[model samples]
Target chain A: MPYKYIGRTHSFKGKTLWEIVGNLKNFGVGRLVVRNTVVERYPEPSYYRILKVETLPQPKEESLDNLRKVKVLLEKTFRGVTNPKPVCIESASYKTDYRLIPKDEEQRYCQYKAPVTNEKIFPSTMELPPLMKEVLIREMKIKGEPVVEPVMDIVYNDKKRRIAKEGEKPTIEIKIGLGKPAALSLYKGIKLE
Target chain B: MFALNVISKTLNLPATKSAVNFQILRWRRKPRWVPIAKSKQFRIPQRPVIIEDEQIELKRLFNNYRTQMKSIKRYIVERFVAARAITTDPKDIQRIFDEDFARCNKINDEWNSDIQSKRIEYFENTLEENINLAKESLQKRLELEQFKLEEAEKIVTEQKELSKTFITADNIDEAIERSLANPVDYNFAVDLDGNKFYNKKTL
Candidate 1:
């Protein structure tokens, strides 16, 4: 995995500019935003569409088809975007150095064989060009000034109440064994009021 | 003479000279007349014996007596003084022994007190040394804890760097807000010196 350094974004001249701090692998890429198109201004925008999509239903064949339609509509809407490159998420798979052959007659002699001439399948690690290295070092030298983060304030109130009722009586009974002196002094501090 | 010879024969007695001759003979033999040689058989060396004067003899006796008397007198005086001044009674002897015993015991007590004081001083010195050792151990433990904290912070920083790629400001702000919402389930308390500490856990 490549290392990434995220920086803060702030509004400058009514435009949100994000600063890239560490490695400049994707420096030219712009920010992503969402936009909507106006088709009609009627009583409601597809109430049945809302009820059908928002409610819970088992995602069987019909639901899968509906999801595909929604994906197609999204792709159609974003297909015209050329300024900010559309990002593609690569799916994970087992990366192998060689392809396996099961029915090759040469497998009796050799257990594994290359499907084709062993041309380098993956690109090798490349060193930065002289011009790019100079630019990278120049950009790395720009230190980011510290920014003060806003403090959050929270207040707490005590609104606790006991679960038992006020006039509740004890259900358990216990016979306490007390000595003579203890029994005489048990109620000595009580007031008549 | 006839009458005396008649008497000696009648009495059958030997004369004195004949008896002496009979006694000198070791073995009896037929009586024979032998003349004895009178020549000097042994020579004797003779020197004149000189006698001491009476006064010198008396002076020698006096000197002997004086030495003997002086020794006896000194012995008697020592015994008499011991009998008079220093009592031969058992109680006085026991009292003297008790005084000597007390003196020895006092000396022994002084030695013991000196040893006890030295032992106390040595014990205090060892205790102080042990305290210093304990303090050094505690200081090392604190330093180790501080090193571990720095290592943990470095790891956390590395992890954050690995996860931060191409993240927009809004996402970062959302993460910050989420982090602030939980706030580590703890309070940040400031001490009297304005140093912050976590109330829920050791830092």
Candidate 2:
């Protein structure tokens, strides 16, 4: 079988495997280091289709000779001072692949779909249940004007309570929790597809 | 412009140097900086400087299209006259306009495709050039590091070898006598100020 080379590899046991040096994932000829956190991920394995391949032109002889001279100078200068090690030169080409998802597959999955429903319930058009709406209005006295007024009143009362407690040397803790109706509505149908 | 110096074959019996040195003379005259006329430097400006943000590029593109349309219209009129297909009917005029519009659109598409191909060629060339440059630089850096390591190794090996041939106490007296007997004069002399001065040998 022909060897498939990706980067610097080392022999472990009897198999030639990719070498992981420090934080770098090294293949026999190439290595890569993560430049950023994985902001995106695939739920399943994906394949990339090769488009075009190109051979880069070789560097000029003059430049190569200059490199050799620099190498010789460095070797001569540090010969007695340090242990010799291989100096790896890394290069990378960005492989930009357009995910070739089938048209029908895209139409089926790349869209918002409501949880399996027996009745026709478009999530976008779904309205709040009447009972929940009444309860919300009654509990919060929400009349469509300003929600900020009530929020300010809560903060003011909390501050007053803290001041009164400071004089009495008592600790007051405030714990906030989601209301039952809101929590139920939020998580009842969403399956995180 | 260079002049090649040639030695006469009789004078040297043979050409002394295989390669001839060509003396290159300065062709272009040296440019001397001339100060701007004092009158022009202090001239009062007739126009006031104005700066404004405007869609200059979009306006230019539209202007170019308008000019192209005008030229096309003129060409169509001339071609129709030459072909002797004169018609005054509004319907016929509208049909001609429609046909020309399609032809113009086709030409535009061809031009756009040509531009795209040219752009792709330029991009590929640029990519290759950039890769070559980067690879060369990286190789040079790696070589430098390796050279440094090799030099360090050489120094250490030499030092170790020298240490192995340490002078014994028994030979120290003989070594001093040998050095004093075969004393060599210093080629360069240093004065009281610690600066080395080369000795000039007299004929």
Candidate 3:
């Protein structure tokens, strides 16, 4: 961690989230916080909850894979939790935000091995590219704008059912349990078109 | 995508077959670590110490906490719903929900710092031992993955005579074997995964 004049920011999807989640899979990340702005008014996510997986530095037994395992466990186990009303999830694990992700420091992620030479003499020169770096720093400026539209929408409706007999419409209160009671109740209340 | 495949191969596990990757998220900063001295007066109220985020292990523990809440809530809701089924009073439902929340929080309490510090110490010690062993084990296995274009290169180099009898789907051994050889009846054949294309076995 270095102290500099500014921070930079950038947006990534698909492989980006995968990389972050992958890094977390083996190692652990700190508690992620989001802007209240991002949490509310994001029409998609009805409930919001952030996840933390255990990671230890010692005997080095804890693997990022443990985080991955846990991610799977949560999603699989909670699949039914947020079904009818999806909870829009926006996740970030930052050394700093993309907007603060300065330009020059973008490409410096950890390198595993040197790019391999193809002469075949011993291809021993081959190497795995180091982990990715925060690259928005070099090519572009980190501009601020309205937060991007929400990206993740997880549903928490595992136990929804109609109590009304075929024709006799029923008024029911179903608690799917994504963990935000207020949001869950409000979402279930808005008239469905 | 490229990296995913690399990891899958490195782990020697089937790619995304049954695995689910989870992410750990921590507060932008260190969580206020409760002081070592257990408070007695509701314990003396004190401000959270905002130290520079240290302890990578502590952060990992938090990520699991973030993700598991959904499941814990579900378990609570299950009991909530089941309890409600027994009676429809609003207060009853509220009581059940409270009970559920309390239980979930209680389970979370088990992973508190008091217990985790030790787990971290043990986990880290074991990790170093494993990494060295892993490096040695993986050294012998060639980790080369031919980029897609390399596939064509391999075909040309391995088989100068590209025209083939076995390569074409029309000439596949399975299809050929299934052709009827008997006068009025035919024997049905299935492939290794035990899936039948067209059952030739007569009822």
| Winning model by lDDT | 2
lDDT tens digits by residue: candidate 3, B48-102: 5533333333454454344344444554466578866755798988998899999
Runs in model 2 lying further than 4 Å from the true structure: A1-193, B1-94, B114-133, B159-175, B180-203
TM per model?
0.19, 0.20, 0.13
**Candidate 1 residue spans exceeding 4 A from truth:** A1-193, B1-88, B164-203
Model 3, position B164, has a per-residue lDDT of 53
The model with the greater TM-score, 1 or 3, is 1
Candidate 1 C-alpha lDDT tens digits along B1-203: 55555556666766632222222335665457754234533433354443435444555456544543444455446657876787789999999989999999999999999999999999999999999999999999999999999999999999989876646776988777877898664578877999877754655
Q: Score the docking of each candidate (DockQ).
A: 0.00, 0.00, 0.01
Worst ten-residue run, lDDT, model 3 chain B?
Answer: B49-58
Q: Residues A103-156, candidate 1: write the lDDT tens digits.
A: 243224232333454322211112233453455456556645343221111111
Best by TM-score: 2
lDDT of 2 at B26: 82
Q: How does model 3 score by TM-score?
A: 0.13
